[model samples]
Target: MSESEKAARLSVFKTYKLFVGGKFPRSESGRVYEVTDSKGRWLANAPQSSRKDARDAVVAARKAFAGWSGATAYNRGQILYRVAEMLEGRRDQFVREVGDAEGLSKSKAGAVVDAAIDRWVWYAGWTDKIAQIVGGANPVAGPYFNLSSPEPTGVVAILAPQESSFLGLVSVVAPVIATGNTAVVVTSEASPLPALSLGEVLATSDLPGGVVNLLSGRTAEIATPLAAHQDVNAIDLAGAEEVLAKELEIAAADNLKRVRRPQPVDWAADPGTERLTSFLETKTVWHPAGGSGSSGAAY
Candidate 1:
């Protein structure tokens, strides 16, 4: 082995801790699952994330919702950008882990990792600005002046897409939090190692506690409870099967949570700014615009 390669091996990843309430802790259930590389070689132990664990995460997310959503848009934008900076700094480690788990060549893994990291930068740029595009004043048939603007739905539950593990996961989470919404992401089951690594990235990022929760377990197992949780304001079924998606949709209807169904995605196709629009609600405002008395100048 080359000198640098030997050093890398010596410093290979240890089993990571779950990020909950801005702290790294082992799963509340005290269970750990064996994570393996593509060739079936053991890599590390990932948290055997549980139902109780999921519920705990939900509590954290709900607790952080008010502050995260109420944070100034400009400040949120800057914090989101900090995540991109941290990810960029750790690109090599991510590429290595993704390559090992997905069995891709180093170059291919690097490209995928780079794309995922860049997606955050793109979303960060949108946090403060997309509001202007998605909301605006409209000329209504009324005497009072009228205006409209967007506000975030609180505490989103996300089923992160399985196909593009890191990128898809980040895509859903970034947009949800970018608009001041807190989230809990159910990470990819088969390839959850990357998700754990991502938790490490977030622990270092300047994000507030509970703003984003990462849980790696059966999506079917955990998603049902979250979908039905009355406190959860919205659901993004961006990665669930039709049956699972339908079930979530039905549960969401009980509280009328804003549900974004999974589309047949063509990865090459542009996801565009649709994600930003999903977390927003338009509120129309009106007030009297009458003129002051013209005779006041006589004084």
Candidate 2:
């Protein structure tokens, strides 16, 4: 064969973009940063998200909260399962990204990607069952029906873990949405491509627009405002450092955002119900019951 015939075709570069409200858009700031593979080879220019981008994501998540939270548990479970399906369909792409992002061998990256997909399936099963597990009836001295249930706390801000980028990101984000809370995720600063690509999967799944908005940029830059935003109902500082986590916690307190402090974890390990309950709020409801009076008033 001639030398020209033996040459490989040039690969088409993919432009990595931010995912917000189920659409891919360039950063509102009109800026981009070069992403590289583990060996320092050029990958693509990922969006450099801004503070306004963070705020916008919060708004999108807020708008999506009611519908998502109001959806039937069975329906939500199916939707989450659909995410797993989409992830499975795009397995090879994620395998490549994970391998490049985490500097793992192709085999190791495939394992990680497989784990992430299974994690989604795990959370999917929890949607219908969690409320029954965490909520129940209580006996009271008065003639009333007292019941408590876990409810979505509205929009949540998440800092995806820095290491184990894809699996960790899925671990954090899945539970939040599985329990009906919408999310604004700030992907790992060092390895954001996988997280950004996951957004594409979410959009293609049956999930509603604005349900899970993702941003890729400085973690603190995006997390700080989300912590303080009044509309935000919770914050997960999984990716923040000691000093930064402390600062974000303080900011979260301004509006009493339910904060999940950073803790070391094996993202590949079996995640129990804690993450599902972490972002949920228990609501106790009381209804008068059972007594008939001669005065024609019944309780």
For each candidate, what TM-score against the reference?
0.90, 0.95
In model 2, which runs have C-alpha deviations exceeding 4 angstroms? Answer: 1-8, 295-299
Error of 1 at 68 (Å): 1.3
* Best-matching candidate per lDDT: 2
Clashing pairs in 2: none
lDDT for model 2: 0.92
Clashing residue pairs found in predicted model 1: none
Candidate 1 displacement at residue 188 in angstroms? 0.4
Provide the RMSD of all predictions against the true structure, rounded to 1 decimal.
3.4, 1.9
The Cα local distance difference test for each model comes to: 0.83, 0.92
Q: Please give, for residues 1-299, the per-residue lDDT of candidate 2 as tens digits.
A: 67887686566788888999999988999988788787898777888898899989988998898899999999999999999999999999999999999899999999999999999999999999998999999899988899999999889999999987899999999999999999999998878999999989998998999999999988888888889899999999999999999999998898888999999998989999999999999999999887756765776
